[model samples]
Target chain A: MFERVLIVEDHESVSNSVKQALNDLGVDNPEHVSYCDYALSWIKKAIVTPQPYDLLITDLSFEEDQTVQQITDGVALIRAVREVQPDLKILVFTAEGRLEVIRPLIEKLGINAYVRKARRDTQELKAAFEAIANGRNYFPLQMKRSERNGHSFNFSTYDITIIRLLAEGKKQKDIPQCLQDNKITPSSLSSLEKRLNQIKDEFSFTTNEQLIAYCKDFKII
Target chain B: MFERVLIVEDHESVSNSVKQALNDLGVDNPEHVSYCDYALSWIKKAIVTPQPYDLLITDLSFEEDQTVQQITDGVALIRAVREVQPDLKILVFTAEGRLEVIRPLIEKLGINAYVRKARRDTQELKAAFEAIANGRNYFPLQMKRSERNGHSFNFSTYDITIIRLLAEGKKQKDIPQCLQDNKITPSSLSSLEKRLNQIKDEFSFTTNEQLIAYCKDFKII
Candidate 1:
């Protein structure tokens, strides 16, 4: 059902293979580019065209080149493109399989799918495309568990603000004053202590430092 | 003081620039290669030669190619080279700047220095080489603090073995029995508890989970 797609990959062999796979999946004229700058330009071009690209499949890391570039990595490119077209469906293709590293991108960027580059990954890629076309998010089963657990526990604005401040090296005693200055609700020292303790208990964390590290790993802060 | 050094980097531009930097530092005959396999073979040749390479500089990630390789990443190459030449000094030059990732290479593999690939990194690389030549280990100042704190506390065999088991997903209650079966000393329940508590207190950790994560970050286990 997909009409248009754009692939951003630095490796020539990888880009060609991905293009071939897209062809076999019945998507014709699937455009590809090796640089983030060119990919951005293509996205911009599609925005004013009669029929815009429906999906963007991109690699995360790009090798360096002689020509200077404003966008060096895919994350920065995603941020830039999102500013121009917020509703574009995105699928990330990367060799980086670390959950902690990629979780923040999915949560913050609202990317539609992530397909790891591995053996039999082409099948996984096709499945991801179909899922995205059906308006559903797709992640590997192992990562699905982490995604569910990450989202199951809801974090309030107050919790996020407190964690962010803690990560910035703010002292517990000084946090109440900082929160009050920002007009954050329930800024009392006792209230803050209770909230932190509750969060620690929920996560089975025994100390504030552990809570901070856990929040960092999950990209909650 | 360095006579011969080998550079292992995949990117031609990066390899050339690093080679230029080495030349500037008055180190002639500085050889460079784009693959880990070539680097390993060169090390083996040097090992049998009358004059062996005095230092090794390697990047962690190499771009994947159509031609499959026996040794793909730099870490595996480091391990292989270390096995053959235990006394060889190694300097890791990588874009991977995270302390959690690089700390293990320093503590477990005994790498001489780590230089992040960033602005003015050529100067940093030169400094790393000089420091290693002077019989000193060089890590960024931020990492130096953690390294000092990590080394300040002494870990006994009992402490390490317990933490290693815990990291392997062993429950606290099940640990004493496991250790006893292995004929480890201080296998009493009370002694195990005391040792764990002492370790936690030393690191200001409040739970066994926190202790395990901390040990993992510092590569203590």
Candidate 2:
């Protein structure tokens, strides 16, 4: 059980719920703040005190309000907190489903756990807390299962370049020229077409439009 | 308290949590199923029996698996269930945040309550259950505040058409021609520009790209 915890979330109901969940988990009287700047300041002041907060539960998106903030969202808050207290355990509880939005938090931020604000989140929260307590990193179960089932593809730099161009509303014929301008190898129109086809085939997509949409949804481009 | 409740959620962990929440709320031994079709069948069977399910708790999205379901998602299930058992109280528990996706459930389907699966959702769930039990429709608190604050814009069909075109990678300069082809009123480029600007100003977005992204994120298009 965590002795001290801080929650960063804008929604009052959500924050209250988090506090209740934490209390149920034996974390008594956890502190909460609505703004990221306030959370950062609290963390900064606490680190110099005799007892520091052990865990941070934060939501990724914060509704914009009248108060101007240097650290506006959860990602920025997490980064700032990491700089000040690198060893503090962080658990992200958010409704954001895009892989592009979530992948960086785990890989780059070195977060202890990632819990989606979805059905049965309390159970997941308890599981995440236990994992962190035992020095293990907890990720969403769906992501792990999908990765294991080969649903997550390894896109090459060339593949990503082509997909990104398409996402930017570039015509198929215009891609080869852009690739040639960038000095990427095998920049011919035929090679580009073949590569696109190969990538689509790997994902069982019938059209380039579907491939582009999938890439965007997954945040690959 | 709901004496007879049925939970339709795909995720095992989420379903278990929902069951636990129901149990805590004094609904003992609530029935649950992973697929929408199975849930529909269960409801159909239950309705014929002496005791009918009084409340239905469902998740909006179900991950695609080997099970080929006629009613795949929660929305469709709700619609189907409504047709068969019009009096059954329905409570949607999902992580979907887009207003575009959620508006229809409330406005068209006439769902009893909507609880977003986020932080402190159990509390919301209890509130929703109580509301439905008392014959009052319950919406997410954040949505209620946003609506009261005038943050929810009422976009007309014309607005959606323009935003959808932009989302489909259509160029701004080429939009007028598409509008003319479809015989939409005031298909002039200047009117298009004026309307686009008005929308941006309403949301304080400086660029068309930002507007497009906002619309997409909120599922407006």
CA-lDDT, candidates in order = 0.78, 0.80
> Ten-residue segment with the worst summed lDDT in candidate 2 chain A?
A143-152
Per-residue lDDT of model 1, residues B141-182, tens digit only: 855544544446778877888876765546667778998899
Tens digit of per-residue lDDT, candidate 1, span A54-152: 899998888675657789899988888898888999999877665655787889998899988754466778889889989898987756544554545
The residue-level lDDT of candidate 1 at B158 comes to: 78
Per-model TM values vs. the true structure: 0.47, 0.63
CAPRI verdict (incorrect, acceptable, medium, high) for model 2: incorrect
lDDT score, candidate 2, position A33: 90
- The TM-scores, chain A only, for the candidates as listed are 0.66, 0.74
Please give the TM-score of chain B in predicted model 2: 0.77
Badly placed stretches (over 4 Å) of model 1 are: A1-4, A9-38, A49-54, A59-89, A94-112, A117-119, A129-143, A147-152, B1-221
Off by over 4 Å in 2: A9-35, A62-70, A93-103, A115-127, A139-216, A219-221, B9-35, B65-68, B94-103, B115-128, B138-221
- RMSD (CA, angstroms), candidate 1: 11.0
